[model samples]
Target: MATFLYRIGRWAFRRRRLVGGLWLGVLVLAVAAAALAPSGEEADLAMPGTESQRAFDLLDERFPQSNSQGAEARLVFRAPDGRRVTAGENRATVADVLGSLEGSDQVASATDPYTTGAVSEDGTIAYSTITYTADAVDLSESAKAALQDAASRARSAGLTVEIGGSALDAEEELGGTTEIIGVAVAAVVLILALGSLVAAGLSLLTAFVGVAIAFGLVSALAVPLGLTSTVAILALMLGLAVGIDYALFITSRYRDERARGSEPEEAAGRAVGTAGSAVVFAGATVVIALVGLGVVGIPELTKMGMGGAGAVALAVLVALTLVPALFGFFGRRVLSRTARKGMRPGGAARSRGREAELPGRDAGRAGLGARWARFVLRRPVAVLMVAGLGLGAVALPALGLELGLPGDESKSVETTQRRAYDLLSQGFGPGFNGPLTVVVDTSESGDTRATTDLVVKTVKGVDGIASVGEPVLNRTEDTAVLTAVPRTAPNSGETKDLVHAMRSALSGVSSGTGAGILVTGTTALNIDISEAMSDALIPYLSVVIGLAVLLLTVVFRSVLVPVKAALGFLLSVGAAFGVLVAVFQWGWAADLIGIEQTGPVMSLMPILIIGIVFGLAMDYEVFLLTRMREAYVHGASPGEAIVSGFRHSGRVVAAAAIIMVSVFAGFIGMNSPTIQTMGVGLAAAVAFDAFLVRMAIAPAVLALLGHRAWWLPRILNRVLPDVDIEGESLSRHDPASSAPSQTSAAEPAPVRQLPVGRD
Candidate 1:
C-alpha cells in the first residue's frame, strides 16, 4: 500500500504547476471570505440575551441606582503611617486625591458627590463609576482612539483601579482571541515553516478554506443554538489545526513518493490513495469526538460541540477535495525534491532496511517488532503494572483542581479603586461587596417585613458578611432589597459562603406570610455555571465516545478497534487532568508555566481538552490502525500487523504529536492566564497520547487481543456500511489507468505480514 501510494504521488508531481495553481486559488478565496465575514460571536452578541450576563442586567431594571456608571471611581485612601483614617491630615490627603481624580484629563465631568446623590454616608470610602461621555456620533477612527487614549491616561495614574464589570472583561477577553483585520499570522507562519513559498502558501490556503467553510457552517447552526465565546475559539483552533495538519500529511507523503520515481499523474493518484484516505478517517474521528459536546447538554457546550463538529467536517472535505484538487492542478513544482531530483534526501529513504536495521531482526531473530513483542509477551503482568502505576502517579495532581478567573494584569486601576476596595473590606467584612441580593416584594407597597426572620438569621450566621443592611423603604414601599454585604471581594470564597448562609436562612424568611426572595450575585452565578458544566460532561463524553467507536468500527471492520481507541484516549485524558491538578492547581510547575496556584484548570478546559486531544489521538489511532488493517487484508496475522504498523507509523505519530504539542504549548506564553492553562493541558494530553497511550497501551492491548481483536458478527459485517477510506482501488495497478511511461501508476497494494507468536 505504501509503495503504491508512492507511485501515484510521483505522477501528481509530474503535472504539478496546474494542480498547484488551482489549489492556491481555492485557498486564497476561502481566506478572503473568512476575513470579510463577521465572527460567529459578534453575530450572537450583536443582539440581547446572548451573553450569560450576571448581576448587571437585573441591577439595570430592579436597582436602577446601583446600575449606572455615575459612580466614577471608588476612592479609598488611608494615611501612609498606621494612623487611623479620621486624622485631619488624612482627610486633607483624601480630599486632595479626590480632587486630583476629578480634575484629571479623562474626567469629562466627575460627578459632584453632594449634588449627584451618589455617595457613601461614611467618609472612609467614596467612589463614582466614571461615566465616559464619548458621543455616539463620534463613530470615526479618531473618536475610538480618543477613548483609548483616555483609558490609557486613567490607568497610567495607577491608583489601583479596577473597571470591575463583565462588559469590559468580555470585550478584553474577546479582543484577545478575536482576529484583527490587519495581519494573517497563520499564513505567514506557514510560509516560513514550509521552506518553499508555494508549499507555505498552500498550507495557508487550505487553512483559510477550512475557516471560511467552518464559519458559514457555524453561523448557520447558531441560528438555532447557543455556545460561549470559548467554543468559538475551540472551533477556530480545530479548523486551523486540521487544515494545516491534513495538508502537511498529504503534501509530505506526496513529495516523498515523487522523489521515489512517479510523475505528476501517478503521484497525485497514489497520494489520494494513501494520504487522502488517512485524512478522511482522521477528520471523522475528530468530528465524532466533538459531537459528544451535544450529549453534555449545556446550551453553550452544545453550541461548541456543534460548531466544532461542523468545522471538523468541513476541514476534512476541504483537505481531501479542494487540497487534492489543487494538488492535481499544481503537481509539478509542489513535489520538487527537498534538495534536487538527482540527490538522495538522506532521510528514511536512505536509511531503511540497511545497516540501520536493528540486529535482532537481521540475526535470524525476526524483526524489531517481533523481538519487542516477544519481550512484552513474556512479561505481560510486569508491563501492565509498570504502565498502570506510571499513569496513576501522573494523575495524582488532578485531585486539587479549582477553576476561576483572576484579575486582569493589563488594566491600570487607579489608587482610589484599590483603596476603596480595601477600605470596604476592612471596614465592613470580607463579604462586604459579595452580597447576596434578595428582593422582597409586598402587596401593600407600604409596610412589609423590614427584617424577615430568615434574613436576620441568615445574615447573622453567614461567615463572610460583616452585617446586613436593614431593608430600605422604596417610594412604592412595596418592594425592598436586603443587601447582605460580604467581607471579601465578590469573586472570593466569602461570596460563596454568603450564598450558603442565605440558603440555610431561607426557611426563616418564609416564616408566617412568605416574602418573595431571589438570591443572585457573582457566587450564585459561578455555582450555576459549574453545575451546568458538570451536568453536561457525561453526555458529552458519551456522545464523543460512541461516535468514535462507530467511526472506528466502520473503518477497521473490527469492534475491538473502537474499544481499544477509547481505552487509549481515556488513559491520556486521565494523565492530562492529573498533570493539570499538580501544576496549575497545586503550583508544581509554577516556575515553568509562570503561574502561581491559578487553581483548577479553566471551567472550559476539561471539555476543550476532551474534544481536541481525543480527536488528535484518534488521528494517530486511525493512522496506525489503517496500516494494521491493510496488512491484515494482505493475509498477515494480527500480531504481525501490529508490529509493522507500530514500527512504520510510530515515527510519524511522534512527529505529528510534537508539532501539535509545540503549537498548543505556544499559548502558555500568551498574555492571558487562561490560555496558559489550556496550553499546558493540551500539550500534556498530546504527549501522553503519543508516547504513553499510543506507543505502549494501544500496542499492548492489540498484542493481547490477537486475531479476535478484529472479530465482528458476520451479520454486522455483511450489513455494515462500506467506505473506501484506504482507497483500495487506487493502490492497484490497472491497464485502463495507463499514463506516461516515465512513472509508476500503481494503486494501493495488499498488506502481508504474519502474527507475532506464529511467525
Candidate 2:
C-alpha cells in the first residue's frame, strides 16, 4: 500500500495540473450535487424494541388521533401590565393572536386557550396551540417565516409572545461561525507548528477542499440515510479536525525528508510512503470505530457514525492525493528559502552517504523528547505506577456518571422556546413542561370509564404525582389518554423515577381491571432512550474495543502492544468522562462554558465521545508507535528505539494534538446544548489521550515492557501478512542512490542487532 501510494504521489507530482484539475472537478460536482440534493431534518428517533417505542407504536396503531406526531407550536401570551389575561384588553390581544395564526395557510388548526382550559389560574398568562400542516422539520421555510412574522405582529400588539416546540426548534438557525472560528484557530496552530505561512495555508486549503467534498456528500446522503441536520455540524467538526491533522502529518514528513536533503519530488514520495501510510492506517481505524457505532442499534447513532466515517475517508483521500500534488507544485518553495539553505549542503548522493552512517550513534542526543524518553527508560516502573495512579484518580468521578437528555431549561435563555419553557414552569410546574400521557386500552375491559377511573385513581396516589388531567377518549372509545403531571422537572432524576413508578402502578391497574395501560410521552421516551443507552454501553464498548484490539494486534504484530493500547485508551476515556462529570454534571465552572445549569451528560454523548476518542487515540498511537516499530525493525536496542521514535514523531504528534483540541473546543461557542456537550466531551477526550495517555503513560509502559512490547507468537507472525507500513517500498526507485532517481530517499538506515529482553 505504501509503495502504491508512493507511485501515485510521484505520478501526481509529475502531472500536478491534471491531479489539481481532477480535484477541482470533484469539488465542483460535489457542490452542485449537494446544492441540488433535498435537505431538511430527517429524524429516525424511534428506539425500536424498547418499551416506550412499543407504547408509541401501540398508540399510533390503536389511536391515530391521539398520536403526537404532527408539528406543533406552543404560543405563550403574557399580559404586560400584570393584568389578568381574561381582562378586556388582554383577552382581545390573545384572541387576535390566535386569529392571526388561524388565518395563516401554514397552520392546520389553532386551539384557543380560553376555550380549551389551557390558561393559568391567575390569568396573567395563557397559551394556545398551533398545529402545522406537516412535521416541524418538514415545514417549508416560508411557513416558518410566516409564523415568525405573526409572532412579531403579536408583540407589536402589546402582547408578550413566545413560541416553543419542535416547529420553532427546527427553524432555529445553525450558523457557520462555529466552523469558521474552529478552522481559524486550527490555522494558527498549523502556522506555528509548520513555521511557514505557505505550509499553514496549504493545510487549511487541503482541509477545506476535503471538507467541502465531505459536506456535500453528507448532505446528499442525508435523505437516503435518514440523517438529521445535526449531521452537517458533526461532519464539519470531524472534517476540519481530521482533515487538517492528516495534511499536517503528511506535510510535516515531506518537510522532514527535505530537511534530510532529499529532492522536492523524492521527498514528497518518501513522505507519502511513510507518514502517508500512517495516515491511511489511522484514518481506517477512525472509520472502523465510527462505522462500528451502528452496532449500537440506534438509527441516529448509525447515521452519525456513517457521516463521520465518510468525511474521514475523504480527508485521507485528499491528504494522499491532493496534498502531494500541491506539494509538487510548490517544490523547493514548500520550504522557506532559509530552511532550504540550512539543509545539509549536499545533493541526494552525499546525503545518502551521511544518512547511512548516522543511526545508532544519534541516540545520546539532548533533544527534549530524547531526554524524556531516557527518563522513562531509567525509571519505567516508577513512571508507569505514578501515571497509572493519576489516571485512576482522575477517573474516579466517572463512577457517579448519570445520563439523560438536556431539557428545554438547558437551552439558551435567548431562545423563545426557553423563555416559553421558563414561563410554563413558573405558571404551572416543571412537570407541565413535560406532561406524561398514560394510554389505556379498554377493549379488554369493555368499560372505557371504568378503565379511565382505575388509571386516574392509581396514578393520583403515586408519591411524586402533582395532578392528573381528565381522561380523553378517542371517538371509538377504545383508547383513553390521561395526562399525568409530576412535581419534578423533566430532566430531574425524580422525574425518571416517577416514570418507573407510574409504569409499575399502571401495570398493576391493568392486571386488576383487565385494561391495557402503557406510559409514554416525551419524558418517557427520553427516559427509555437514556436507559437503553446505559444498557448498551458495555456491549458497545466491548465490541468497539475488541475490534480495535484485534486490528492493533494485527498491525503491530504484538499481543502486549494491542492490550496496552486498548487498556490505556480506556483509562484516557474514563478520565475524560471524569472531567465531564466534574464540569457539567458536578457544575464546576459550568457557567464559563455557557451552561447555566448542570444536568446529566447527554445520553448519546458518552457513546459518541467514546467512539470518536477511541479512533483519535488510535491515530496518535499509530503515528507515534509506528515510528518506534520502524526503529525496532531496524534492530535498534529497545531503549534506543523508544528514544529514536520519540525524537522523530513527538513534535508532530504534539502539534496535531493542539490542532485537534482547538478545533473541538471551538464548538463550545455554538448555541445548541447538544453541540456544547459534544464540544466539551470530545475536547477533554482528545486532550487526555494526546497529552496524558499517548505522550506519558504509553511510553512509560512500553519502556517497562522492553522487547516484550513487540512479542508476537511465532505461528501468528507467519500467518499474519507483513503490512509494509515502514516505507520499504520507497527503495524500489532508490531515491537515496549516488545516481539520482525520480523517487528515492537518504540511504536506508543500517540494521543493528536487536536488543535482548531486559526484564
Give one digit per residue, the lDDT tens place, for model 2 in 393-412: 98899999999887678887
20-81 per-residue lDDT for model 1 (tens digits):
55655755665565466433332111111212233335445556655333212333333233
**C-alpha lDDT score of every prediction, in listed order:** 0.56, 0.80
TM-score of each: 0.74, 0.92
- The TM-score of predicted model 1 comes to 0.74
Candidate maximizing TM-score:
2
